[model samples]
Target: MERAGFWSRLWALLLDGLMITIPLNLIWFMYQGEWTNNITQGWAWDIVYAAYMTILPVIWNGYVIGKRVLTIQIRKEGDQPVGLLQMFIREIIGKLFLGIATFGIASIISAFMIAFREDKRAIHDKLARTYVKNRI
Candidate 1:
């Protein structure tokens, strides 16, 4: 299986960001009964982001909405199913933990790793021992 290239993965990320944002925005609207307040000021957005990353791949065969559209999927190093533990490490530890504590600096480093590293493994994938593979 071919490894997914950085640009393709980046596009997939953008798409997934949009997908996550839309529903989150709606939830904010319904909760606050307004559309202008900042949702990032609290833990709601963070929780949503964590759940989106962790839960989706576990239930969807490693294919989040963007990965599904981009013909890419996350897998164990040897093409195994992504375990819940792996998902938790990747999503919660690698993304949410670093994102919160570092104010996204660590996530930025992960982006650079994806852009320049030979295997295109981000910090999350490295921590989880996973890879994103092109489906076709």
Candidate 2:
């Protein structure tokens, strides 16, 4: 399979974020009957949402709904199935840093670097020893 391009991978990420966010927000609102404006609560929700986003692909062989739709799957550097520990580290550490930038500036820069790197890896991908590839 061909390596997935940066734009394609980015689109998949955005799609995944939306897929996770909409439902999570809906559930949060349903439970609370209004949008919760508390920063602490928001942060708590972020933690929950992050876990939801991270755990699924890690456990499911890297084919989250967005990735499945985009015909992309994440694998280890050698194209093997990504291990749980690697996924945990990637999600908790790498993704958390990407999220800290809010508008994905960090992710964009990382993607650009990945595009030129010998290994074809984004920052998160590098840190986790993972790569997103087109599904055959």
Candidate 3:
């Protein structure tokens, strides 16, 4: 039940972000013939990102694509699998709200918390009473 390290978690998140971005960019390119128009579709992308974070982990047993690839999983406080409600709280309330309110500044802070905190719990993880751990 060892907590996942900050670097590992950061790389996983980047992978997930890329997973979302690459497809969207390709679709935009095919439809609009350009990939540089991301700003105009930021809101739509955010919604997709929110859905990605919330639904995937619950359906995938606490592992998003990135987490699965990285051999890490999100778990409840007692090392149990995350419930749907927990995923909602973590991804919607904690991540989505903070991401929008601060224009993604809060996510940066969450990374710092994970990096420096003894428990390696980011704000979202603390809010959801969840932690990322190396999958057994």
Candidate 4:
């Protein structure tokens, strides 16, 4: 498997944002009986989004919506597919909490790391012992 480049990872993330938000907003509308930017209103939305990120790959053989669309996948250094604990570490602990603790600086640096590093791993991937690579 070849490592995914920065641009593919970046585009997958943008697609993932749309893949997550639209359904979340629709569910918010269903539950709240209205649509008023509810997906951005609270921490619950964040948890839901994080859950979406954390859970899907484990169940889908390293495919969440955007990664599937982009033909990339998350896997360990040994090329094994990620599991739930790894995904939780990668998404919740590594990305969200660490990003918050560092005031987004870690995330900014992670982007650069992905762009420049030969392995294309960000902080979260390193934390989870994971990497993104081309599907083929």
Model 2: per-residue Cα lDDT over 33-105, one tens digit each: 8764352255776787567657777788887778889998889877798777777767776777665855677
- lDDT of candidates 1 onward, in order: 0.87, 0.75, 0.88, 0.90
Flag regions of model 1 displaced more than 4 Å.
30-33
Name the 10 consecutive residues with the lowest summed lDDT in model 3: 34-43
Report the Cα lDDT for residue 92, model 2. Answer: 70
Model 3 lDDT tens row, 97-125: 97779999989999899989889998899
TM-score for each model = 0.87, 0.78, 0.87, 0.92
Candidate 1 matches the true fold with a TM-score of: 0.87
**Cα lDDT of model 2 overall?**
0.75
**CA deviation > 4 Å runs, candidate 3:** 37-41, 102-105
Question: Residue 26 CA error for candidate 4 (Å)?
Answer: 2.3
Question: Root-mean-square deviation of each candidate, in angstroms?
Answer: 1.9, 3.4, 2.1, 1.4
- Name the weakest run of 10 consecutive residues (lDDT summed) in model 1: 36-45
56-125: candidate 4 lDDT, tens digit per residue: 9999999888899999999977999899999999999999999999999999999999999988999999
Per-residue CA lDDT of model 1 for 35-93, tens digit only, reads 85365456877787778888899899999999999999999888998989999999899
lDDT at position 96, candidate 4 = 95
